[model samples]
Target: MKYSLVASLILQGSLVLGTRDLQPVHFKAPSALHFRDIVRNDTYDFGCRPIAHPTEDGQFTLHALLTESQIAHLTEEYEDTDLSIHRPSEKRAAAATAPIGSGDRFSGGTIAPIGLGTKASGSTISSILNVKEISSAVQGLVSTYGVTTLNLPYKTFNGATQFAAYVGAGTDKSQYHLYLSAGVHARERGGPDNLIYWISDLLAASKAGSGLTYGKKTYTNAQVKSVLAAGIVFFPLVNPDGVTYDQSSGSLWRKNRNTKSGSSGDSIGVDINRNFDFLWNFKKYFDPSEAPASTSPSSETFYGTAAASEPETKNHVSIYDSFPKIRWFMDIHSAAGDILYSWGDDDDQTTSTTMNFLNSAYDGKRGPVGDSAYKEYIPSVDLTNIKTAATAAVNAMKAVGGRSYITQQAVGLYPTSGASDDYSFSRFWAKSGVNKVYGYTMEFGYSTNFYPTLTEFNQNILDTNAGFMDWALAAISVGLT
Candidate 1:
């Protein structure tokens, strides 16, 4: 009876998901442009922002989280067109999602979270870390490995004190050149785990004067030390409030819990990834036709009240100011299985230096790929360095004997505004005398599968740890100073 009611309301195009499950659906279109039309609508949730992946049949596949009503609406709308939508059997999908860790796995900051790099083959993580365990895991490292944790300025909407950890560079903040962050989108499980465990491996291996291995991939003591010397500063659990809600309710939540906009389910949060200060005022910065980020509070890609409006977004931006010399930055996300690099606002062009994001002269002409209008300008040399680092990360991930990975320009399937990678890279051009930081977004695991099975969870740690290994080494090769 409830489902029938939902279906009826969906036909009227007025019903929203209220404690209902979000079905995972895939839409295949003859060309990628068909997705551009879908992206403009504010009702859908594209995992960590949509990027259309090419299928073997010469079509594009976009993975989305939608209600049964939304899927039914799209099914009816595209029935006569070349576009098609599909969902797997509910029973099969129901059992495959991995479980979230029920108790504090870190035992309230006493036990360090060990990664797959140190475990035997086929070993699995019991579950994804609970929200409190994310903090506990990092604190365990402080006592065990001499890690320093610094508190950020802003408290979350829930009044949570956010903190970041930096090691190997000592007390001088400017000495750190590599920065990493995870859990920006709360439901991307294992993102914080991947970073924390990798840091554990680096510190442990350095202390023992040993090597680290992730399945078939291996890193020597020298490689580990080189990456450590680059000085990594990590901000894990950017949206603890949202994560706690998602873990407790199993709602697949993807934003920070801020109620200033709307105070109910599906309308209670802002996407931290989309709330960054780069091209954040999408209506003014991007092409008028493009919905690079949504304006609606209920939308998954909502840009929020203003640029860097949410405390999570502000805390992330403040990291760069605290560490002025950070030469490389990475924001970890999941389920896309690719490593993405900068200029996500539009197609990247290496020729015209003046046609960049800061110029108000090209304000209304910035998006739309393959057009004669303005494309985001990137220096050819900078482009090469980003591409090199991106390729190295994905290559090492593929070499882990688990899955194949690829590198892509961040703006591949659809353009995005205010994304972390673009904001990191834009700082070099937007600010005066700041270090030029090449930004990257690493999307790991299966397509749209944020909650991995136990096997995939273990595999994700292996794949990402190796990827981080090569990513840091490649950055060092490109020169940190």
Candidate 2:
């Protein structure tokens, strides 16, 4: 007896495949940590804010942005006691005094589109609208399916809620479970658009192909509906406050608006990504002043006052905790074509097996090891030779003309704390006692800033959604079923 496997490409509310069978395949996780040094250097540079010329007393007034602990650590390591440090306030004032139009200044940009496309007049492919409009459009496709909302409350913003919509078999005995989310970072244009279009297409396709497509490789309309019927929840925007702030105030807003720290001005929010509980405060380099003002409120890269301090972070944690059956979760981002995996905060010293799994999944072909002399200076996780499954997914995506790279946390491009993928993995291990929960952070598209040409933007969304769903479905087929 041959069992047929059907995969549905759900975007634009349409079914686009026939049925096929699951082939015997071997998958291994990645072991090597590449791009670690580059990330480490970036983090270091973020801490190093060069000083202006000499101060009033003819002494060079250097501003050390590092925390007290970081300063202490550096001092002990390098024995540089002569260095003077400035407080967060002084730094803020200095930054403010600098001209906004100055090339050296870091001006917070905007993510809002300069023009709005009317529903009927706008191109079907690219148009960034409010959440309400996106939601209304999706309702047309999955109206019959039960819709359950997860109201994630926000404290910083009055009565703000992070929205999630569930469609499929109602939380009971669903064969294939999938969780879809976008806009974890508000500035990413692809997040919201991809989510809305994917849902719409999935529904429309399922309706049109009810019985036309079938089997393992190809999905029939019925199979597509069954997958949806099995249960798929869509969280369109995870960081509502951050996204709203990005649109209205600053395009560079990466954290939530929650003021956990007691400081006023510049340092007014926590990098919600760095506010998770696992390996909680493990900074690659020691930086005490890096700590948020009140341990609650922060300006940038703030790791909340404590674990789960921000409501947005809590909302994610709660969702993962409440749903044990959620086998797959993807936290979407943009600007980089990356599909990052678990243990992001720090190295998972205990879980070498997980690292190996990731390595193999990524098909570990070591890059040029750029500037080998500088390689040893990089920080990286020590693991076996196996490649990461996340990397494999990225490679597969890349093989098809998708640009991607596997990077270590704190050592690749950016070092972050309290990420959703890390949090979800921890929660999964705790709840299920099994570390099979495959979570990823997908950075979609490189050419497009917040607003790319509609055609290019739409295609990028389609390709990414396709690649993601394909890998996800394939991974699920191989691992889960």
- The per-prediction CA RMSD against the true structure, in angstroms, equals 4.8, 17.4
List model 1 lDDT by residue over 144-177, tens digit each. 8888999999999999999999998888999899
**Which candidate achieves the best lDDT against the true structure?**
1
- Pairs clashing within candidate 1: none
Task: List candidate 1 segments past 4 Å from native.
Answer: 1-18, 89-92
Q: For each candidate, what is the lDDT? A: 0.86, 0.45
How do the predictions measure up, each by TM-score?
0.94, 0.59
lDDT of 2 at 350: 41
Q: Give the clash count for model 1.
A: 0
